[model samples]
Target: MLLELLLASVLGFIIYRFVYGDKEETLPLDDGWWGPGSRPSGREDESIRPFKVETSDEEIKDLHQRIDRIRLTPPLEDSRFHYGFNSNYLKKVLSYWRNEFDWKKQVEILNSYPHFKTKIEGLDIHFIHVKPPQLSSGRTPKPLLMVHGWPGSFFEFYKIIPLLTNPKSHGLSDEHVFEIICPSIPGYSFSEAPSKKGFNSVSTARIFYKLMQRLGFQEFYIQGGDWGALICTNIAQLVPSHVKGLHLNMALVLGNRYTLTLPLGQRVAALLGYTERDIELLFPFKEKVFYSLMRESGYMHIQSTKPDTVGCALNDSPVGLAAYILEKFSTWTNSEFRDLEDGGLERKFSLQDLLTNIMLYWTTGCIVSSQRYYKENMGQGFMNQKHDRMKVYVPTGFAAFPCEIMHMPEKWVRTKYPKLLSYSYMARGGHFAAFEEPELLARDIQKFVGLVEQQ
Candidate 1:
């Protein structure tokens, strides 16, 4: 008993030191040139140019031809989405896409927002800038940058833009009107893909910081999920002074000693600082955390290790790409959807919106580039990156969506973001918070902003 007690005390002390002993450190603010060929000797053009989304008849024809030629294997009997995207339901989706879906109309919708491209670090970064349609006298809209993640584009923010930029029209308060900037992570959509290697989240964050600076913003708020969450987190770590506040719908705070205590059971977890909600979301540990990750993370393993090989196959076949990407939307949004025939895709999203997102990847021929991001960011392994070890100092807000792929407790988030100011248990939503539940996410953002301003 004495020996066991001694070992426990030593282990506890080690964990305490590892989690709380380190002095705050900032990730090195590095620079990179992602474009093909050697870095240019001259200065990069800083002009922000207007851009529009356009589609040709040939593009439409090709898409239809590809859809018609797609030869999908029949799904196993009653498999639903458990084994993957149900081919039975995929046929229904393809019929609508080929017959009812209008690419031209979708293109126009994409162009509704003011799209712009600027050359940053030899790459043309694409983003949409939306300002408040109406603002009270002497009230300037806050500049907020909302980034998109893998298999998603800036299109994800369309629903939430109006709520943030013109709240009064949407039956919400205008106290926090925002001039929103939704940028495509380079190589995702319209943004030019990096021709060279070693372009990771930190590099993207630096380029975005420069973009914000060129836009004349001294300080701004940032928000994101998935890869966006990591990129935004890097921005905060790289330059906390320039980020007025940080907001995230998802966070990557696992892979630490704290997570190792889960097997100790709920009684001990509560003593380790996990709340009841955390316990509820995390218990049945074998099923929720362990098996869930094992089931859902097959794509991550593929993307991180051999993205290019699969990217080639996906980028070539539109049908293959849709299945690959849409499967994530279905599972990540609500894993339980896997039990449904249609994957419950339309429960919270429309075919038009979902297909529009897929079209961005298809039209831009950027699937390969987008998949490479996983390799660049995670190829080195988890918690191996310098930024992973550093805690964010800027005021941070986190919205814990109930159906998110993994539930992050406030205790876990606080370890990485020591200045966390707002932590809300969102009523309803999943991975795609803005796309799935815009009002809920917008309200959380406003609440977090209010807290930051109060501080």
Candidate 2:
């Protein structure tokens, strides 16, 4: 009995030591987590300014007339999709967009939000800034910058903006109130398109750091999903001191092909639940990963190889634009709804809200420029680019969405973001979490910041 008691005490002491002893030390800012890559030292070409957004009454009338024409014309019958085109749905959607979608109203709705444009690293970055209505008697409103990804816009946070900024009114203010700033990544929306060839993720990070500095935010929280995650990660790495914390919906790890192809034994263990703590610590998403990779990665292959060729067609044709964006809306949200025509978008979003995002791209004629994002980042030898580095030190929090096209399990995420603090498996939400599940996302964001702040 005494021996057994001693063994139990020893085991308890060992477990306690393992849990609490010799914790990982947070790195200092001077460690150069941003890496030592040479950033091009250049000035903005004053000659190339942001294009004037045509929001005049006459312009609105002209846009309505063009949409009306597309509606009146009968689309090609015998609707087809995926492999080719869906003429029937095309006609229906165009009719709804032209006759019912109300672009003028959407314009006004967009104007309702406080929008601003600022110059950053030779680009005019556009962002929506909404301040909380009330601040505690002594506290100033905290700034939070939310970024959107490709095939998405700042519109992703339209719903969440109100919830964050005026939480008392929305019954969530007590939970969390954020002075929200949602930016349309350069080349995505009102933001100025990059004038040069080499505007990749890391460059964006540096530019945004300068932006926050200009805005007088010595420190602020950052949040993003999709390519937004890339920018957030970059910001954290580039200037970890200025960035207070980062919350990501799509926490992608910039891993090489080595991590992509794990060994057979580890793979089997992940499936059979026989993987050891050491092995399981490394391999997170072994089960069902193969299925996701095979099913939803057609666009990656196409974009990586031939983006410009595809961008040209999408830019010119309105029908092509709808097809490209809508297809992703369907497949990415949930695989169960993969075969459905609408992709179950209505399950989380209204057709009106969905069309607003599409119309933004269509009207701006920036569809091609947006697709070029892929080309710029995925161009020849991009992975092997001299500036490529995967170390990030920002206080990072990640939400693992079950239905995301690419899943980055916690262990895998730790490889790229060694400072990762909080990891949660989101019960719901897919790629478009901010849009599809704002309440849940807001809760997670609050939790993430709260934990990091406490630390």
Candidate 3:
């Protein structure tokens, strides 16, 4: 009897630890100041200021001169993009940028929506706030905060903004209209970079939470991909009550026991709660998950360790900067593009749109600051952060994009987001879903919102 009681007690303890531990807890909302100098004693500025994207003739002249001065080294015969951005294809992109791409017009498009900046945590946080142009009678739009990842700006959502804010105008369902707020992650584009060390995703989440509170939104929906996904997850972890719904195109749920079993073969993976779709996306494990990560993570290793060294060169040369950033656009959009001569860039995006993104980095001189984000987030180690161990209590939704660097199965997502209410396998898209397939992404967001509202 004593032995049986001890055995029962051990099993029950394990069950309780697995099922109840940390489920209802939230991350402590810590304070931070990222400005260069010491924190000011008085309250920081809380006023929002109107902002515009501007460029002078001198800026245009300097860009043209740099393009003209570019020296090309011929790519290996028939190398395609296997090694990197092919110099051969880069010449064509540079030619278009120098001769035809219009910066002033793109700038005008950038300013079409309402752009504003407000001081938060000693930084000028830049964001575009777009309200529904027209709404149905007796209905108000839902407030949604969408964040962009590294090497991407608020511009990624420009095409998707209209679809969400005015679905009826786009011939879609008008049931779920949104008041969209897309903010540049601090140090990415126009948002100011952190001067101090240890400014990680948790700090960003707290700052964005403060921003939403200042905007008079006590509750709002949040969405993101890449780094944005992690930051938004932190937000949900920090303040579960404030976040109505958490949606993501990508999820960082690796390094857990579930993921460790991925290498046990498809039969075991299926037995471990992975769906058929998950098996299909994750199998051929060596190529799809392991080697692919090894191949694509070189830039991450560099940025996480010694970003300033490379940032110096990228900031100094326009052509070099284009080659560095645009390479990710090519391969990340579709890994198979590496086999094509032009990296299949023109298939999904126009040269004008691509260069416009590159120009944001060039003009802002923010490449170094942006690179430092990787170091702060992952420089210490992965899976060691407090938020990583915490499960989010907010209702969550995930869109599993087919070619997103690495595939995240719904089973894995549910581990971190126990309240996951929707998980859709997106029809088509890769890392830059909003920029590449705006209509598809918008519809998915509507679908997720509908489900959340029903609950």
Candidate 4:
């Protein structure tokens, strides 16, 4: 049996209240201050500063010493990843990380792009701003904001940035050259973690919106997956005029009553507004959808209620953190990868690439803060929030990557986004779409922008 890469069980409400009404609800764009203690007197600083990633010998030596001492537990016979990262295979990764992995080289790769920080809500907001190296005559690059989700950082967009910014060099048409801004959500990587409570996606959207204004973009395109998807949606909601277009690879749209007919709805799917592809991807509901959802959600349950407790060990032990985080990369990339002895981790991604992501959490010690976001967002319960009850009025485009943990039908997406202009069923890829399939994602983004530009 092959396991599909599991979704962030952090997706709220196993038994969601799937209701739709004619209320025409809109999101309230509220302001916030997320610093520790009470809000400080006087205005918050609004200066932007250039930043670079650097690693020292002391950091490398400390990491090496930790890896050398990781005690291992043995896995049961041929368990593979059924029981989580097989400890047997982890030894291989440990050996590579301990003996061959190069943090300094990866740091250099990270710094290849321009990075900057600005204070938003009293927290240092980190983001990368990429401009086309050369522009055609009389052309201005389009501005875009790409937000990252949990277990992922701005690094995921590195490969795709050049493809979008300098498409002419990559054999793609130069119709949509872009100036891209990829931001680190507060409490992730280089972005300062929120010291106070209630720092959910809404605050994040406001902060990123402020970031765009600080960068002098009155309006821009927004894209994301996982938490990034929700943040982009909130950005559209909070300030629809400021968002020119919204693109996503993941959505948290809870299914309405019609979703329950999935097992036998294949034959009558069209009658109910579902596409053939939706039926093909969603049917066999028990194995592919229900059980898979249940199997993958343990982390969400723990994170939503006690993220700090679960993340304590993860923050303390790098190997443990890798096991916890990398397991998602394996199972989520392609569920079938779970059966391989090595979890088939490198099939679509290099260890260097994967470890660099892990290093972000390890170096920043933001695991607990990152996990707490789930608690802050979902601990209060799903569908009970203001944004959950609203619809995004912005023009939207969706890249439905075939292997995405769950399929978001066109009709389903339209319920949340009234003006969905483009919906493409991608030929390949999964949850971490940008990281695994840059060209495909980039092309999809370009295609969506083309459609948006025309309208």
Candidate 5:
């Protein structure tokens, strides 16, 4: 117990140092105990245990029953996803989920890649670690950590995993093979949730960094989008030297001067260093930034303040959980998709793939803990943390998917990632870049790392 208290004090000091320490700052290699109640005596277990995703008939039956019993409100005539996951479309997904979506098969696919769980800070941190099947002689696989965000699971990278780990077989250059590690953010799925409050992206980054070191990696690359983007960014900030390179498909460059000039018209926006594509996507700034944030951020507002309240219903009702989670997949993948009758979900993702992700949350009953992350990070205020204001010094690459809900120009991404080495306007895809455009994302990662290697 005393050790746990000491751990807490040490973590606090580390964060304080990062915020107030000198310019030559480096985040501490602190330890923690995140298990429930009081931390146990003695050094925490450091063993890595192999894991497999499993499901039972009863669990499947219960989910099917919930789908059978769902009482969906009717979408107003001609109304699409504008009002959220349209009830009409939810029916199609629910029908497939109940009748044809095979959870057992999906579980097998999930287990195809090796998984491991190790205790970090008292919580069982779950991650999938995949090494390249075959490396050229004298070649060593690069370690890449891919993090997922809200309404997303490690499953987001399942398709992209094979590509990165075996690019030679995937018809892509084998110049940079990766041993990929995709960890479920604590409380996201198989990973154990923090017993106490205040576990946010920074804590996640620290845990993941330790996870790599424990797996025998002293330095590795990091890649992410959504909350994953922020978590990877924090890893770079906390331990820039440990990160060989950082890559992101999404960025949180809020309140930067680049965004501030967005409303000044494209002429002024260009003066601020935006590209013509940026002007095309960001003009009528009200519709793109202000109105979009206002319209889409309702969930953020509630989750940041009262996550448990909303998470209660979501955890209890599988259908309600799907509606809540899938809504983001629809709008985030392409805001315009929301105008379609089916919300255009299946255009980019298979129903089995989508439901498999939802099932991770549904089976684990982690909606509440996962929702609490928002409160931990944003409950205080957006961009209010030390890392939020700090610039990352590590070499960074960004892939700007055109259909991302809010268009973040290259200039905006560069402001936060000062060491931005590569930026690409992805030909197609949206927030779920890896899921929708695995080949494209994989190529970009390879391209970015290739440049870093050249340096």
Candidate 6:
């Protein structure tokens, strides 16, 4: 009995150290953000065409055909054995993707929403621009730009677009309608992969700021999660003049401040899950986020240092692609299914939906490019310093997800965003909030934007 207790204590101490010991290392910058001109070139021009939209039947049909072909030949089921996955027994995921995965159906579904493309800073940016159905009735929709993170695309917003753009469709007030524009981050999918080395988060932020200006939106609201949150915060700092407000999932630099100031009890609570009061105060769900981070985020550590080494394999092998990307679908969603083959894709996302996202990476040959984002950004420690927070004057709202890799309590977040307005503890959802819990995320965005618009 005493030995067992000693083992438990040692295990707990190790986890606590692993979680809290690493303060972000400050790396020397090669080239700082806006070393010359802080302000991005160009202003909103009334005559500039916002975007070129081509929803022709023939083009849409070809996309559907491609989706059909992908469904016919499903991904290899060798992720466990090849990738050294802990579990030996794999789920019947292949049968589900082949038999049940409806790609043509999903393409038509995605095409139902309007799509647009525009050039900004020598890159072609793809986005979905959904306007409220009642715009002709003289109610102007608030323009909201939603950005997706790594391993995600503009498709993440498909579920939440209607809920935000046409609130009445969701049985919500028409007064809360929004004009949502979700963009694929550069190098992710449809958006052009940057051909240079210095295209980090700050650069993406600046280019996106230009995209917004080209769209004729003088003022706009911003929303994002993961890498999206990092870019959005940079936008808030870079173009405070144009961005009216900012909302984010997975707060960044804010975590740094918590390590610097919060009380010891709160710090311990943040690091190790101990106090019921802290649990009640922070996350409502009793999910084990730390284990998933350790297991799933091994890729992040690799990508940070030697992205090219692993990225080359993914770039070459289709089976390698499935193992690298699809594995996250299992562990990141929750702790209970950490070893499951399907990774609980069916629980929150349809087979077709999940496969489509994977296919986007596959078809674009962007798996390598996307992983390179980590090398360019983290390898340089941009997030640790260059992208550090300034005094953000714009209104801000934050939705704290229950199963996110990290938690940033309101008190901790205030260290960076001193003017924070809304902080809500999300009842449920993981890191991929837009894709997994779109309705809830959409509603929260509308509620927060409604408050910002009113102000």
| Best model number under TM-score | 1
Model 3 segments beyond 4 Å from truth?
Answer: 1-22
Q: Write the per-residue lDDT of candidate 6 for residues 81-118, one digit (tens) a residue.
A: 33433232222444454456555566677778777676
**What local lDDT score does residue 384 receive in model 4, on the 0 to 100 scale?**
71
Candidate 2 Cα errors over 4 Å, as ranges: 1-87, 173-176, 254-267, 271-287, 381-389
Clashing pairs in 1: none
5 versus 6: better lDDT goes to = 5
lDDT of 2 at 247: 88
Work out the TM-score per prediction.
0.95, 0.79, 0.95, 0.94, 0.94, 0.77
Where is model 1 more than 4 Å wrong at Cα? Answer: 1-20
Instruction: Tell me the tens digit of each residue's lDDT in model 4 across 1-455.
Output: 11222221112223232443544555676778888778898988999999999889998898888998899999999899999999998998988899899999999999999999999888999999999987758999999999889789999998999999999889888899999999999999999999898899999999999999999999899999999999999999889998899999998775344554555546777678787788888877776777777777889899999999988899889999999999999888777777898887988899999999999999989999999999999998656787876778889999998877778888778867879999999998888999999999999899999999998
Q: What lDDT would each prediction earn against the true structure?
A: 0.89, 0.67, 0.88, 0.86, 0.86, 0.66
Please report the TM-score between candidate 3 and the true structure.
0.95
lDDT of 3: 0.88
RMSD of each: 3.8, 9.8, 5.6, 3.7, 6.3, 8.1
Per-residue error for 390 in candidate 3, Å, reads: 0.9
Ranking by TM-score: 1, 3, 4, 5, 2, 6
lDDT per residue for candidate 3 within 215-271, as digits (tens), equals 999999999998999999999999999999999999887634466666668999878
